[model samples]
Target: MQEEKRRGQNRDIDLDTLDGQIIRALQQDGRASIRDLAASFGATRELVSHRLRLLTEHEGLRVVAALDPGFAGHHVLTHSMVLVDGPVGPVAERLAELPDAVFVSMVSGAFPLVFESRHGSVEELHESLDWVRGLPGVQRVRVTTYSEILKGFFVSPERRQISLDSIDYALIAILQRDGRTSYRALAEAVHLSASSARARVHRLIDAGVIRISAIKSGGISRNRLAIGIGITARGGTEPIGRYLAVSPAIDFAARSHGNYDFVATLVGASSSTLLTVIDELRTIPEVGAIESWAHFDIVKEDYARTLGRVLGP
Candidate 1:
């Protein structure tokens, strides 16, 4: 990650530990043998098996190889940052009600609300933006177009283990938009026959390139509070980012080039604990500036939102 940051690029998660082994292996090839992961971790398969179960039940982690939209013809991937002064729940709720909205956050950054809003086409995107631009509490929205995605996974970087092909890239882009793309249709799109396409998709699955699955969004815990924190690091982002990544309360954290330099998205069980976490973050020597935002409700959560135009059946 440090090397990637030096190059102004991103490093995929590392997958070397027992837990990382389980997450990455299962994410790409869901049916991987515990014995194999255990061997990689220098532990017994039973122990690895137990750890895997805990990761699922306790962490609520899903090793999903979600679809890519580019191949299925819904190619646009748009991100928007929003700012709001007052209660974000009301506005978040209203926005979340829309099936098209995805990945909503109330953070203390350049954009209070960052979304992976989608569109089937450029014309359609502009049309939808017309409505999103008018949403209440949305002080302003700046949209950025993502032409390509180098990497994405639900689990940490340590879990992303796979190789890709030209076809895999094209297939992922399509599946990002249309998760239900059939093997036959995929073959036709990528200039392969049905059999080859099916084999390639399965290989990509084993290699950890893409996944075909359903998108469900009801995992919110009433005990969990979404707290957005921005930390400015003096030594560099890696140390602080690693610190936040291992934190029990932190849910989604990233090193960004923006107002705070680094952002940590955490899930606090209670308000007091959340504040305590903030205090701890502030105490870190490298931290220069820290800002936080608390949310009462989450508007939207969809993995496919990255491809843009999140839609429902």
Candidate 2:
């Protein structure tokens, strides 16, 4: 009863126009100051601060630093669809608890439970899949390994060789928890001057080692429809993948080596809105065949992972 009441209260927390503006601003720069946001919007700092607090407290808004998989030493990324023999809720709950799971959801399709996981190496990924196969309700699992991620909120297109020290790793750990952590706090934690800490963070961000952004808990709207798309291209996957990546409706798109040449995730306000996007995709000459699944519920969507796992010994 208490859990039900809590969920009811959460759903009742309405977001006004100011809330939307604040969210967008934070999405662009999660570390933006409250004073700066107020000045940009021409609103009172108190009002903006109050709204920001409410959004985080009720809307499940998280501002965190997300690392590039390749830059962070994560060599393998894969999306898995699981067919369950019995109740899917229990199986999905277990899957969400897995450390490597960056995203997990229940969808309305042949495969009910789907998840995306990251790994340090191919060997580690296989061992993780073996463990998943042993789970009680899992009947079958199909995996699509990502060769290149063309678009994703946490990923950067550019890759560069940059050396990171223990201090850098420590700063990354802190920011992963709270991207808005003050430079003073970071300096205190790392035993460095605030200016030095700020410089290091800027250097890391400039190098495309990490992205600081806001991550929402679920679909942006109550009526939002989320779809997973698998595309087979006529010639090469690059052109199709790049096209899908640029669409405003598509949040994630990647080139993969599996049953499908490319895979993407789309979010829209309604079925009609999503269908229109799909129609446009079909019109692309390079696109051959497409398979899509409607997501029913997003059980988990956290991207933060232990840096040590990827850092190696």
Candidate 3:
């Protein structure tokens, strides 16, 4: 292994123990201030801020606020599996450009590209998929609609009854791009006083309308094994879903109403560790059968939303 250089010289700034800890802390609270991070890391506030800036500017790491698609006028969320007759790269890129696409990736398995999309209604989703199926290199498309979201990475499960105006939408759009943006900047972007902008952000967070968390950069090495596991629950999926949610190896888990009762993403340092986690899942009495697929490469992963259409003028 090569010795990693400091100063974020290249896209390969090695994540040391401190860096990992900082990331975990940010995942828990992306809006944490420099003083808070410094206290947690036992470092000076200035040092902590410098490190964070280096990661964001050079290593592609970002902190972003995630919004509930439903709250943003998207009532339907769908998971799609796409098979391409020709090159997968071009097909995957085209899928990513779809307005409703929330997440898209090229994987190793029965499907070459898998993506999650959000829509305002069933008709909209269908039309989007119809256009995708008609794409030149497209061979087939498999769709699985999410009934209820058990967990959505960084988003809260609870729904807010709050109504939003243009100001709120503008603020959300800014945060979606950079969750670490300063209060002064947020106010300037949305044309509000800094104090008022700060207040509104807290209200949104407390209302469970949105959440902020650190996003791991795509430049990060894929040396570690990454897999997607589909699970069939014997009874109600609550128990199994809860169990998987707390597992350290599992990054994403959710209850679904499709071929599987639940779906999860797991990452481990090695194949053995990955297998070990799967073996543990097998031990769960509520788990019936499990299917696993290794992730080949993540072609495009974007969580940002186009608020103008959904939020409306």
Candidate 4:
């Protein structure tokens, strides 16, 4: 019993620089070994080990082997944008408790709330929507079927306080298609030289402007239903959105405003896993007051590559 108490106490500390580095390294490659991280970061193995322990125990940060959901059986992918008109708290919390709801976010402008979920078929997706649409405070819902995916949102470089430029967007566009493209190859695509391309890539990466790496896929074709959900937030959207974005189950979460109060996207290994993720989201304390809808099909999944329309940084 004493040992259990001690173990619980160990999980409450904040992450330091070295720990953050560990996260960064894992972000680059989840399969990295402690030996590799220690050597590269100039930290002792013991130090690295202890830091890892603290991160998991105290910070509640986890190191999980995220797999390609498609490998597990989920074949359909979709995006849903939800808007809530009541207290965003209970609703967001309820959404977070979902198992398949891996991504949930709140936004500021047009559609305030959004979500993306994966499922096995359109019929099952419609069934899920029937439940979401009936939730209290839901204003309206829309759906988009994604025929193709231009990009997938992923980990970006750490943020930098520098101003952004159109060149940044150009660089992003090139990398979005092929993150591992060599500098020479990128230059060729964007009409520049190899050295220049190299410099730009490094600078952008360091500046938290972009991240270049490969994301695993299920090795199968993907089709999806994108859902747009609207709800009235009784409290506000920011708190609920922020909480959902940081959820451990979420692949990526963000805030946007339009027809919805917030927008988020989640991934799952299968339809059941997706449903489970959404169930978990529905349990978040902040989401007690909420509403949602399931998108029937995905029209387009541009992912973060849509920076093109955002006008560069």
Q: What lDDT tens digits, residue by residue, belong to model 1 across residues 187-266?
A: 99999998998787676655433454422233334334567666667876556766776776675565555455665566
| lDDT of model 2, residue 274 | 87
| Candidate 4 lDDT score relative to the true structure | 0.50
lDDT of 4 by residue, 1-313 (tens): 9666545544453335576566556546543567797787776566677876665565543332222233223445555556678754455455555444544444333445554555557786787667667777666555543333322234342346555566655776766664545667778877878888777777766665555432322111122122222323445555556555565434444343333344444443245655665666566544543344443322222233234332324
Candidate 3: residue pairs that collide:
none
Q: Candidate 1 — worst ten consecutive residues by lDDT sum? A: 7-16
lDDT (CA) per prediction: 0.58, 0.83, 0.76, 0.50
- RMSD, each candidate, Å? 12.0, 6.7, 5.0, 15.3
Q: Residue 169 in model 4: shift from native, Å?
A: 42
Cα lDDT over the full model 2? 0.83
* Greater-TM-score candidate between 2 and 4: 2
Give me the displacement of residue 220 in model 1, in angstroms.
13
User: What is the descending TM-score order?
Assistant: 2, 3, 1, 4
Off by over 4 Å in 1: 1-21, 24-31, 154-209, 212-300, 304-313
Judged by lDDT relative to the true structure, which candidate is superior, 3 or 4? 3
Model 4: residues >4 Å from true position, as ranges?
1-16, 97-99, 142-313
